[model samples]
Target: MKDVQTCLNAMTVDVEDFFHVSAFDKIIKPQDWDQYQPRVDGNTRRLLDIFSRHGVKSTFFVLGWVAERYPELIKEIHAQGHEIASHGYAHRRATEQDRQTFLADVRRSKNHLEDLLGEAVIGYRAPSFSIGYSNEWAFEVLAELGFSYSSSTYPVKHDLYGTPDWPRFAYQRAEQIMEIPIPTLKMMGRQIPIGGGGYFRLYPYALTHYLVNKYLDKEKQPYSFYFHPWEIDADQPRLNNASAKSRFRHYVNLQHTESKLDRLLQDFRWSTMKDVYGVNV
Candidate 1:
């Protein structure tokens, strides 16, 4: 194993409540989002505390809807020295909208976050890593809106979202926009996702650890890992009405995520995406 302690990786949190996840969209309408109790503030604060204990700074992609409801939470994240970036005004995927609609969604989010921080919020991640070949235009929209970089693409195959053929590392997408894909490992002539998400929860921590270390040692590049606040909240209300597959994906190994995350933090050196990728925002 490589001495991962010497290499800094990018740690990120998608700051949204469980109900905001796309898997529950069919069961939980956006209009009825208020009906569900909000657990993101507490869950995210829990992550912030964990990051603090490990002396790790992460980028938080704040959803505009959450910022609108919990302004103090957004401010608290910034106060604690984490980079604040946009997760769009709503959780709508870029693939589901037209170019104009997508533009409006991101613009509203960027403006909202900037209004909160009193500084430009130049980093963005599309909901669910939703940007792909079909919606490549989204990058132009992101650039048009003054974003410095986007960690919005995953270069692996998945039923939900993935641009398997996209660059696996940071590359410029537009004049001022850089697209940083989540880290993956090339194995058996295919890309295996080692970056965090449901895969972190699904696999044994030992396996995840090995893959991450392998990627770091072989790729010789900073790995970026992401997870949602809800992933650690095992007790968050369950939407049983949603499909079984969605529930399984959302709730699988929830009880163990926090502990696993703590271990992951202790095992790796971490910093914000801006610092790791040298993106000016």
Candidate 2:
């Protein structure tokens, strides 16, 4: 986010517990999701309050179910001056299901957020950046569902998600719907992704700063940086079944998060995702 603040002048916030991920999907059922409410919600509130104090606004990709149960949380986020976008109803991966079901899920989540926010909801980012080559139709679904843009594709090669062949910078897809691919720096003819989550956790801050600056100097595009509220909450309960890989990815830089964030806020200008891509209101 510091890189984004330094380079793009904005950040995107995705709200979800560590367990809601695909690796732990087998363990946590929809009925059991509420068990994590107290921890996740409180931590999220802290994040919102922190951003509020900084006077930093962002585009919050909220889960629809969370919005339904915690409408006040949604209101609180908006009240503090942030843009609201959908993260689908239940955090399902787009490629895991068929096209029609995926489309329905998009529409369901979109409508749910628009109703709660009382504003036109135009953005939709798939859970885990799940929309890829297999689910390209997901974009068509988003357009049909009245969504104006999507940040669902990460333009890199990853085991979980990314579309290396897609355009790396923000651009209009087919002249109507927009595709805001995650920020990537082209190196030696290869697109290397250094934005958000794992990159934020594993890589050193200096490298991230250099990478974002490199992109700005060369590519001249806004670099997208994303983070979850739980990331900054050092005390968030660890998912018991999280594997070694998951554990490392989740916990690597917890202690340094707050400090890093402070540096980030100071280094660059930060705005909401909408503001970066020129999304109107």
Top TM-score: which candidate number?
Answer: 1
lDDT of 1 by residue, 1-281 (tens): 65566788999988899988998988888899888789999998888889889888999999999998889999999999999999998899889999999999899988988898999998999998999989888888898899999999999988889999889989986556999999999999999988888999999999998998898888889999999999999999878888999999999999999999998998888999999999985
- Taking all chains together, each candidate's TM-score versus the true structure is 0.98, 0.91
- Number of the top candidate by lDDT? 1
Candidate 2 wrongly placed segments (more than 4 Å): 1-8
Task: Please provide, for model 2 over 165-260, each residue's C-alpha lDDT reduced to its tens digit, 9 standing for 90 to 100.
Answer: 888878888737888888888899888787777687677877777887777777767767788877787777777676777677778888777667
Runs in model 1 deviating more than 4 A are none
**Candidate 2 lDDT (Cα, 0 to 1):** 0.78
Error of 1 at 245 (Å): 1.2
- For candidate 1, give the lDDT of residue 53: 91
